[model samples]
Target: MDYDVFDLGDVRLQSGITLPDAKLAYKTYGRLNAGKSNAIVYPTWYSGQHYDNEWLIGEGMALDPSTYFIIIPNMLGNGLSSSPSTTPPPHDRARFPHVTMYDNVQMQHRLVTERFGVERLELVTGWSMGAGQTYQWAVSHPDMVRRILPFCGSAKTSLHNIVFLEGVKGALTADAAWDNGWYREQPGVGLRALARVYAGWGFSQQFYRERIYEREPLGYGSLEDFLVGFWEGLFIKRDADNLLAMLWTWQNADVGRTPGFDGVAEALAAIRAPAIVMPAEQDLYFPPEDSEWEVAHMPDAELRVIPGAWGHFAGGGLNPVDTKFIDDALKELLAKDV
Candidate 1:
């Protein structure tokens, strides 16, 4: 929960909507070296805040704070940042303007340069929506970023990803309590439904077949108990409007269209940083093949699939095998010369 805010005055988004007081919330770990070249920027995932990324930031980890200065920025609409729940006046709730991955990267660039005097990053890495932002960073400011490690995410939101997001949006909006995203009370029924939908897509079929829900971190007695207790519990603390804002951002995540590139190839080819894309093998939402296709178009990129049966949740390092895969990939990525 330790965080600092960077005020960028009036910030205008890609959608041409302006918020008078725009701020980014972030948390920093370790100390910046005298050389200032040891900085690593790790953005948070969907519905995740600074603390959620702490698992990858401890001692002996790939992003060990002792070896590198790590900055974890909470993406917009993640509740802790300038989100629906925290924004004021006209920009609050449903009125909050649309923010694209481009906007998030641009704002993060400002945060690093203006607040921390970090002109270049040693590494930019993240998972899920955070990984999407990592791709944006490499394309938007290639020279300023040394390397990128995007796990379980694509440079562009695939058609399948858009459809999946639409399902989430539909579930949220279908609740009578949603009330057009400005509900007086939290949309309990809709949130539960949204959680249920995520459960199906977030984990692999093998995970369910083996009844992995009966294990650590999410142990439940029955199938019904797992759905209600685990899935519902995850989304209940979040604001529905905030989740919707993130979902929309996730749906429209496309680097090619963001800055008006001629095509996807042009966007991918623009990146000069060495990128290591680690997609989970069983991740239905962000399949490994999508990353493989995107990486093929990039000037310098490598595809590394996290081998596990946990699907998209593998990027969260829920399983030991996936955690080792992440750690090994990151270590190798950082060791390379850029």
Candidate 2:
């Protein structure tokens, strides 16, 4: 990936907070065709960056840069991008306002269209929260995105997901030393509690049942020790405030929001592009049933359930995700007269 930076200029978040120093860190691959219509946007997931999925970006891969120009934009709240953790003083973690996945996509739209002068995109694709943004892109700018591929994401974050994130936040705040999510001064150690909550729910019982517990043995002689080590490893370097910001964004994801659209399903129905939703059959956060419900409602949509026990992580865990699924769809979409 060719890492680069985009000076996004001032960004007014959905919270009505204006960040004058806002910028988006992104990476691009392949030569954009002279027509600039062969572009694809691949957004990042929660707690993940563009470089995190380098495995799926080689020759003959589904995201082959050889054929298409791919842009991977780091979502807001990711440290590399203009986020709470790394923002300039006065806009730091303790004072940063809330932003949603829809807000991130709108920023990306400016980067792709206003900055790069790209009139339209061949496709927009991502997993998890990034998938939520991809869905938002299709909704807000139907004429811009030619097609969409959302994997392991929901159009709107479910109430259950919101409750789960609240539980994680509660766990962190209940550590007594948390100090109302403003403990960046001492660098709160209570974040470990939050990470523990995440780890337990991130993976599934199948992971334990299948004996894939190299990091933290599922049936250790002492479960607390394993759980502690598990939490320490993941949250050891990440800041608690930054973690909470990303979780909040993930929890409040929706296709439509302020600064543009409203009514997620209505925006979705307005999409002129074909869509593909690859959901995990056993996904705990975004159930296949949800994807099925979505596909049935979308004007032109298809569903491919990844059969795995990886739960919400099935998208990355089941690497490749049948590349032909994307290839066949792309061939069909781009072949039609626009």
* Best by the TM-score measure: 1
Clash pairs detected, candidate 2: none
TM-score of each: 0.97, 0.87
Clashing pairs in 1: none
Q: lDDT of candidate 1 vs native?
A: 0.90
* C-alpha positional error of residue 152 in candidate 1 after TM-score superposition, expressed in Å: 0.2
Which candidate number has the best lDDT? 1
Q: Which residue window of length 10 is worst by lDDT in model 1?
A: 256-265
TM-score of 1: 0.97
Candidate 1 regions with alpha-carbon error over 4 angstroms:
none
Worst 10 residues of 2 by lDDT: 213-222
List model 2 lDDT by residue over 1-338, tens digit each.
35777887788887788876787889988878888877889898877778865545666665678888888999888777877788887888757678787678888998898767897998888888878888888887888988888888988888888888888888777876656656635345566777777776765678646645443223444455556655456575666667778888888777756345566666667777788788877777788888887777689888977665666766663334434454454455556565
List, residue by residue over 203-246, the lDDT tens digit for candidate 1. 99998998888887667898889888878888988999999999
